[model samples]
Target: MSYTPLVDAEGFAAFPAPAKLNLFLHIVGRRADGYHLLESIFQLVDAHDTVWLRVRDDGQIVHHNPMPNVPAETDLTVRAAKLLQTATGVSYGVDIRVDKRLPMGGGMGGGSSDAATVLLALNRLWHVNWQRQALMDLGLQLGADVPFFIFGRNALVEGIGEIMTPIETEATDFVVLHPPVHVPTPAIFGDPELTRNTPSLKVSLLEGTADWRVLRNDLESVAVRKYPQIAQHIQWLSQYAPARMTGSGSCVFAAFVAKDVEKNTSQNQANAVIFGLPKEMSGFVTSSLQEHQLLGFASD
Candidate 1:
């Protein structure tokens, strides 16, 4: 789909902000500063939300739709634009039109990815050319998940998603089932019985492990306890591949070991089912992305 470009002195710039999955999240402990320490493998997916933007003369940030449930002022897209405007000292403003295809609060990093796209797109559109570290710093202020999107790869994230280390894996495809329901992330994290002390594993060990069955999301049980639909989806997807909850999920995904084999050989595979939300809810199956793609409004 094409977007109508907002007028700007320097024209427009666009970026494709992709969603991500936490292959496994282990919350180790809470620090004295109250930040939760975590370890997870973050893999970006090809499915994405497109954000279109152009510089505005008055330095005002505007978002289309403004997300009914989330406050306009508190939305990450607005905060991200404001942060970039302040950091770059660019007198220019931005008009951002977000095509939000990714399900909100699905543990898919939709909002955070959008925020990261804004930062990255604005840096180029505004001619800021700030270093990657600077962009990451700007992204972190927006949200914990934002920085990892900036890195734009499969990553081993730690320390509330600030710390990033690259990881490589065999090509894999995922079928993610999203329930129409919204699962509040904070509520799951705040659960008293939530596991917060999974022993950390080395990056080398993770690389050597072929069977992902050994890795797990420590928060999955707590999430299942909070939302039974999550548990149900997990059960359904597990029949196809080793499926588990992603982040604090209302969305769960399974990785196929052999895409070709599964597509042709798995005759008994059941039809995919999405629970909680209506059968009409939109969902997707996409492969992992090597790098994030940038999109925007273009004069045609």
Candidate 2:
């Protein structure tokens, strides 16, 4: 869905804040701050949000949206703009618009990614001149997954998703499936049975795997237990590729190497399965972006 509103000032600047998959999340421990310490590989996907900004002469951040049901103040796009204005003390404001494609509460880091894109996009549009690290630091205050979008690469993340280490792996394509449901992140996180003490593994070890063995979502079992539909989808998808839950729950994905091969296989099997979804929910493959796109704005 598109949320287009003109920022009442200079022309706009735009950026892509892509969705991410926790290839594997290990909950190693908990911190004194009531936060769980984690180790995971966060892979950025082609899925993203496009955020547009226009500088304001009056030093006041004004966030607007053309979308019918979306509230302006509650939108992450607005919060992100305010965050940049507050942190840098730049004597300027921005008029903001967000073209959202990522699904909300899908464990795809949509909101966090949008926040990161705004922080990085505004640093340039407003001439804040903060380095990448500075932008990332500013992002952490907004959300845990925010920093990953700033770096814009597949990373080994720890410490509530802040600490990052860039890693290289053979690129692959994904077939993402979104069921018609929203899974609240807090519900999964606060579950008493959620494993909070998974041991961490080294990057060197994961690189040596024959298949995605050690790479698993720590919350998958809990999510499936809570939502039986997730378990059913996983069973359906596993017939094609090694499938798993991306983040907390709701959206599950399977990876395939060749499009035709995956297609032919999926076509042959058909019991209680839905295929050829409308453009919005259609399953397809995507590669990770080397970095988030920072460029011009558009509305539709």
TM-scores for candidates 1 onward, in order = 0.84, 0.82
* Superposed Cα RMSD, model 2: 5.9
Task: Name the weakest run of 10 consecutive residues (lDDT summed) in model 1.
Answer: 265-274
Q: Can you write out model 1's per-residue Cα lDDT over 1-300, one digit (the tens) per residue? A: 333334446454556789998888889888887667898888888778877786788978877668778777788888998888887799998887778898888999999999998887787778787777778877888888888787766877888878888777556667788866678878878888988887777555456653445689888898888788778777766766788888888888877544465454221132233333246444566667765664221111
- Per-model lDDT: 0.75, 0.71
**Top model by TM-score, which number?**
1
Tens digits of lDDT, candidate 2, 242-297: 88988886888876443454455433332113353344343545555544554222
Model 2, position 278: C-alpha lDDT score: 42
The regions of model 2 sitting more than 4 angstroms off are 1-10, 66-70, 206-214, 258-282, 294-300
Prediction 2 global C-alpha lDDT:
0.71
Cα RMSD (Å) per model?
5.2, 5.9
Clashing pairs in 2: none
Report the alpha-carbon TM-score of model 1 versus the true structure: 0.84
